[model samples]
Target: MILLFQQPELPKDQPATETQQYGFELSDFLSENIWYLLIFVLVTALVIFDYYRRKKEKNNGN
Candidate 1:
């Protein structure tokens, strides 16, 4: 498995740069934006679920 913070080597044909030399993984992204993205997803899911639930309730005349 690849490590999140592992710094990958520069491409053989390309010159080494500070940014490109270091590759990021999915865990790194989530760790950095966990609070923001996680909350956004959770809130979005709740809103969508609630919308469908309310629609069903209305259709059922409740």
Candidate 2:
């Protein structure tokens, strides 16, 4: 178990590389999921707004 938990040391001269670039890509992600697919469960306000808008339109329509 100790052997599994222990990590091998790396050279002190170089920094460790990151797998991903951090921070959100708001525009592309928001457009792809929300605007196109309308995955409403992710956002509470959007779900509520969509429900109200649909209800209002259904009631108001001839």
Candidate 3:
């Protein structure tokens, strides 16, 4: 089991740098772009709602 998920060992003589330690942190990214994420979600929801509303109206008319 351990061998199934073994990772490459880093050199003990040199400590891992900050860039190597934490690359592309999603929590930090989301916090920084929370506004954009919210806007995207809102827009996507609105578009999906509008599509279903229009489809329901068409079905009712037919």
Q: Which structure among the candidates has the greatest TM-score?
A: 3
User: In every candidate, how many clashes are there?
Assistant: 0, 0, 0
Whole-model lDDT values for every prediction: 0.86, 0.70, 0.91
lDDT of candidate model 2 versus the reference:
0.70
**Tens-digit per-residue lDDT, 1-62, candidate 2:** 78997769965776534433444466657876775555456577788899999999999995
* Model 3, span 1-62: residue lDDT tens: 88978878865688877766988677888999999999999999999999999999999999
Q: For model 3, where is the 10-residue window of minimal lDDT? A: 10-19
Error of 3 at 24 (Å): 1.6
Which pairs of residues collide in candidate 2?
Answer: none
When 1 and 3 are scored with TM-score, the better candidate is 3
Q: Which stretches of candidate 3 lie over 4 Å from their true place?
A: 1-14, 17-22
Measured against the true structure, the TM-scores of the candidates, in listed sequence, are 0.54, 0.32, 0.67
lDDT of 1 by residue, 1-62 (tens): 57986778855686867546777667778899999998999999999999999999999995
Total residue pair clashes for candidate 1: 0
Give the candidates in order of lDDT, highest first: 3, 1, 2
